[model samples]
Target: MARTGTRSTIGRTPPELWPSGGTLVSTDLLDDGSVDAIAVPLVPAVEGEHGAQPGEGAADVSALYGIDLAEIADRVGLTGASGESYVLQLPRAVGSAVQLPWQALPPRVVLLGLGARSAADLRHAGAALARASRGLGRVLTTAGVQGSQSASQAAQAARAFAEGYLLAAYRPPTSATGPAPAPSAELVLLGRDGTRVTAALDAARTAAAATWLVRDLTTTPSSTKTPAWLADQAKRLAARRGLETQVLTPRELSAQGFGGILAVGAGSASTPRLVVVRYTPTNASGRHVVLVGKGITFDTGGISIKPRESMVTMKTDMAGAAVALATVLAAADSGLAHAVTAVLPLAENHFGASSYRPGDVLRVYGGTTVEVANTDAEGRLVLADALAWADATLEPDVLVDVATLTGAAAVGLGKQRGALFGTDDALVAALERAGEAVGEPLWRLPLVEDYADAVRSDVADLRHVPADAGLGAGAITAALFLREFVGSRRWAHLDIAGPARATSDRHEITEGATGFGARLLLQYLADLR
Candidate 1:
């Protein structure tokens, strides 16, 4: 239900306005008049603790503004409790009476809880602040109040806070009832080391905005975002970002023998497309990394249709492709030195007279034959073609493929993390570190060599899926099938079936299109550089 012509905007503010490395300034030197709201972090009191007491931050606010924060907490039943938030409006007398920069005092003060003193807690606190400060124009925060941590830890906390705030502030309405509201708030970090905090904030904003782009693409209804539409988007992005783009049509696909993509997309009226996006920096490090994403714009499961209930959120099946596209663009925007390429195989698996049938033998791109067992396993087919193409042509140093491939992945990892399968331990370890650093957790699942037999075919080289429904290791079997394309190369497969779509709002993640791998992959590529 996205409004026509209403595209998601990226980097609304100019780069100059974005926080960056700069000279530090004292809190005393900052003009309070510039800030409409001031946010301070508070930790929870220990269990069985009684009367309201002033935390260090509250004490600082009390002395700075002449407001008794402890008394206010007592009256309002706030005990510096975990996950609790309280806001106080300062009267003109107290607001203007501050000793330092009395004329520049903020009118409102916010107390946010740091529950458990964990990273998750800090992110939630930041999300809460973002929701509360929706209408406020300029906000300032004191890094010292988050916790007694080192400079590195403080920068991390600041980055988390900024990410949470910006991501939670996003609202992509489906209805075109009125013009979308403009962003009202601007963030300012109050600390001694402006350069460090600025760099952290800038990085967080870039990463989060890229995530939002993925969310926008995935959340758009399938009807509006067909395979051609996705190709157009990639072309536009490439043009704007100075990346190289190539989109192959159905005729070209047939000529090149991309049977996997052609077979899966044959059912739909919209033809299939394979989009290649490359970012080659000047004098690049020569570390070629290829990323392949399953771009099923919509999945009706072809002839093997899903249940009515199961089809509700199937529009998110292309989340992997969206992440891939967003990751490459973000890397280019950040001026990374590594050479990156994204292969996106775009298609729609629909049910029609022309739909490819079961038991059909498909000679995939690299001349490997595959027997179609379950049409619902179409994501792997498209991904297989791109993987094979990358392997044959790109000769990448590291190859990664991402897809919302199986429900069994959700059954195994739940929605908290994606299932990662890889041949190289070093690549797997690096991806895990990146995922962890960006809060997109990935759990490594073994590519059981024994499970390779599950996908073996009687007539062809392999089967699209196991013939037996009761067979276990569904996620593993899918990964093994992809491994057939990339032989002896460092490869990793991310089955993001569970984490691609959010079941409910949590922390900085919205209720749809979680943008799972965009930031993780970008972080991984950045680490390589």
Candidate 2:
């Protein structure tokens, strides 16, 4: 329950659930006393060059003050290595010369390295500067503004920089240790012609705000985030963006025969819910995409419980649902022409007397029966019900589902990228391109038709888990099990077990749930035909 029309950041501060009221951005010229700090990019010296070279902002500084920044770089041993930074005191750097620009200047100037000037390198550079600017209120930066690149390339680079900055600024709400450092009040990106990259800047900010919301939702403790609670949040999300929301109660789910979802939630104190969010454009004339996410607020592995240490971070098991919810909201916020709908199956897999045992046969939507081999492999069960329901009822042209479904995904792909399994090559290529552009890379893992027999059950249509005594491809087997429900629809599956939560902060990822699929999915939908 939030008041309407607050006007903060992307679109209204969006209730207290989202801590970042979003940050205000501007493309105005530098004004003294208006900013806390300024970041100037320094291109490192090439093979035989003399010293570090100044980027757009540094060049402007040299022109305005009549000084040699290169000389200072040489004296200070500043090499423009990627992620390298040199701090310069504003008034002190100018020496005793006349400070002709204004009475007061920014307190500090950060000279950051732009190695190779590639998008990936610049994105890292932006994150580094943002992390360093922790205490500052307002900061101006030119980390990605290279004068030698084309207008389009410059705009792309600027977009990456702004996105990285906003993403790195996110800090989850905490109470154990006093107050956490607040995100910067405002961020200013310097454009070449004062307003040239304004649209790109705004788009980047909106997308980043969506990512922040996902992070907030995923990191919340399960003590507060239940299936019914997530349904309530759906209403809040629908209200913030002009969209439609619907919730299916336990009774409705039972009547509809969503056995997979109901079976997983039988052990938990809270009931299950299926939340649907839909977005239709003003002039709807594009391909329809249906998105499904696995929302397990807390996973205790049902009857087969996990180790105590393994359950510590289980609160973030709902990250995939967070990604889907945020991406659909972002599509509406950006006003994408394509019609998009998100189906989230919400439940908590707790261990209790009522939990489904290892040999129970549960029927999913569309009357597809599955044998429960191990209760821990519950993600695919819920996703199966949603995927079947969406394909049968939603009339979607394409289907995509995201989930933190398997530890084997992290074992195979490490912690950097997600595992992508899809039937359509063109759709897979589009998703890969979108992921590459957003720094959320995806590695394609085969659906391996030969391995399909491993999931077949002797007592049911399929077994949710593979044989424990023989085969090993857990991630692939899980995807193949989910594929059975798609029923010829062009679909893609994202197994984000590794990248969904970060073990340690790196790149633009925080220590909690990474909010992995939000940015990549939004980018894909934005560019969809």
lDDT on C-alpha atoms for all candidate structures:
0.79, 0.81
How much does candidate 1 score in TM-score? 0.90
Candidate 1's C-alpha runs over 4 A off are: 1-34, 46-57, 74-83, 89-105, 116-118, 143-151, 173-184
Q: Please provide, for model 1 over 44-161, each residue's C-alpha lDDT reduced to its tens digit, 9 standing for 90 to 100.
A: 5666865445543456666677666666676777655434567777655445346442235777777766666566666677777776677787766652334466778877777776
Q: What are the candidates' C-alpha RMSDs?
A: 3.7, 4.9
- For each candidate, give its TM-score against the true structure: 0.90, 0.90
Tens digits of lDDT, candidate 2, 176-227: 4446546653666654332436656667777887888788888777877889
By TM-score, the best candidate is 2
What's the number of clashes in each of the models? Answer: 2, 0
